[model samples]
Target: MSQHALLNSVEHSDLKVITQAGAEYGDNLWFTPTFPQEFRAVSAYYPIFFHKDPATDTFHAVALFGFTHNDNLFLDGDHWQAGYIPLSLRRQPFLIGRQRFKEDGMDKEQRVIHIDLAHPRVSRSQGEPLFLPLGGNSDYLDHMAELLETLHLGMEDGQDFVENLKRLALLEVVTLELTLNDGSQHQMVGFYTIDEARLAQLDGETLAELNRRGHLLAIYLAIASQSRMRDLLARKNQRLGL
Candidate 1:
């Protein structure tokens, strides 16, 4: 159960958030949603893949962190052994919420920050403060606001990015099969990858259009990130002492 509420200086001015990487703080995730804006950084460290929502049928880009659920090879003790952490994971315990109000006699919706009091990272005694002594937003809170804005805009653009990929028929199902040093077999299915053949067969006009929209680079980055799968396997092997 989560106790989420609108963040306010009056009632929750003393709130603090832990800024550490560990499974105890719920950082053990196999993947997290990502966007094209972050593809350059994300691709440098993790394999990028696509997953479709079963209920909405909408596609989302994700950064793979491990071979199985509840596993994050990048996590070592209380530290995240990665150069780049996904924004979705970084913006923990806080989420963007919509609030409706009347602006100039017209209904309008605005994004607000909501914090989960029950989050493992949430603490009142020891952690980064959310507000200053004089009731001003703390540096951490300001950073969180900026992160939320980036995430919101990136997700909006991601929807269009997925739509464009669908239009080009560049996405195809993939199955990843791996054998561990311990003689354990693992298979990952229901994920999508860029179809290199289809991408190559696109007409010049379409290619130019994709380039103009800055999506061609993102597509290539996603494709190139697949090489990191080997790195993940190596991490797993190291963990297993094999």
Candidate 2:
């Protein structure tokens, strides 16, 4: 269960957040939602792919971390081996929520910061403080706010990008088959990747439109990111001592 509550300095002044990368803090994820703004950084160390939700029939982007669920190849002890971490994973214990208020007799909703009180990263005496001694926002909190805003925008934009890919038929379902050094086999299905042939065949106008929307770069980045899967495979091998 999540103990989500609106963050305030007066009520949570003593709250501190653990910044280290650790499985105990819920970093043991096989993959996490990713966005185009972080694509350059994410693609450097993770394979970017698209996934379709069967219930919602909506498409979204992700950064693959391992071959199976709950397996994070990036987590080595309490340290993340990657130089760049995805925004979704980095902004843990804090979530962006909406709050309503009256502004000049007009009711409006605004994005607000909410923290999970029960998270393992939450504490009083350890790690970085959320508020200063004088009840002002700490530098860490300020940074987290900016990160959340970026992530929020990125998520929205990524949804549009995926929809455009789907409309253009630039996405192709694929299966990931791998054989381990120990003669073990693994197969993963229902993942979507760029359809290079369709992408290459797109007319000039469609290509220009994609480039104008800033999705062309992200598409290329996703294509280029497939190479990182080899590194993930290597990490798995090392983990298994194979």
Candidate 3:
């Protein structure tokens, strides 16, 4: 679906809403009502889920999901918070995987068209077509589905094989260099970004490295761990010796 599509909840069948427990009340999406507004513009609305886990007083894992939203932003759901909350609360919300921006006062100049694989929040949702870096949505989801299947298996083996790889190699830092469809390069690190658009371009060997290293699988399992997908992944893992 396009980015302008609306996401709903399965049970409620209502547009998914996140009600943050605080004095200031957080609602809506993408730091602006633009998403809801865009939904009204078009007659398309699909189901999505918003889950929050505030196990520690310091961190929360707020997961937003859409059934058909085939974007990389949501796929990297496991790359959540690290470090302590800083004195500047300005970035604290987005840093811990919470939605911000509507309060932060983003640039109205940024048209809701182009892709921002690196956006702190927008990077994770499959809303509109902002960037086409990964190439057309040809085999993107298919490849990712297969990879996620492997991750499910690995997680079932009682070995977070991917995360272990990172800990063993001590690769806490990484530099990502992405080549967009236009051959332009965008680089970042520390829970960077990986949209389906760009992921489609990755060769099998490269994806294999990502899967083995745990970086890619970490994201996959993080998102799939709590769902039935984990069971699916586990079954696949047994078959592949993952």
Q: Report the lDDT tens digits of candidate 1 across residue range 116-235.
A: 999999999989999999989998999999999999999998889899999999999999999988898999988999999999999999999988878899999999999999999999
Count of clashing residue pairs in every prediction: 0, 0, 16
Indicate the TM-score of model 3.
0.18
Judge candidate 1 against the unseen true structure and give its global Cα lDDT, from 0 to 1.
Answer: 0.94
Error of 2 at 198 (Å): 1.2
lDDT of each: 0.94, 0.93, 0.29
Q: Return the lDDT, model 1, position 154.
A: 93
Model 1 lDDT at residue 160: 91
- Which residue ranges in model 3 land beyond 4 Å of their true spot? 1-153, 170-172, 181-183, 191-242
- Best-to-worst lDDT order: 1, 2, 3
Question: What would you estimate as the lDDT of candidate 3?
Answer: 0.29
Query: lDDT, candidate 1, residue 63?
Result: 98
Per-residue CA lDDT of model 2 for 99-179, tens digit only, reads 999999999999999999999999998999999898789999999999999999999999899989999999999999988
lDDT of 3 by residue, 1-242 (tens): 12332121221122111212222222212111111111111112111111222463221112222111232111223331212111112121221111234535753331111221233333233322222344343243333334334433433332343233333342233353444444555543323112344556667886787666544644343334234323323332443354
Off by over 4 Å in 2: none
- Cα deviation of 188 in candidate 2 (Å)? 1.1
Ranked by TM-score, the better of candidates 2 and 3 is 2
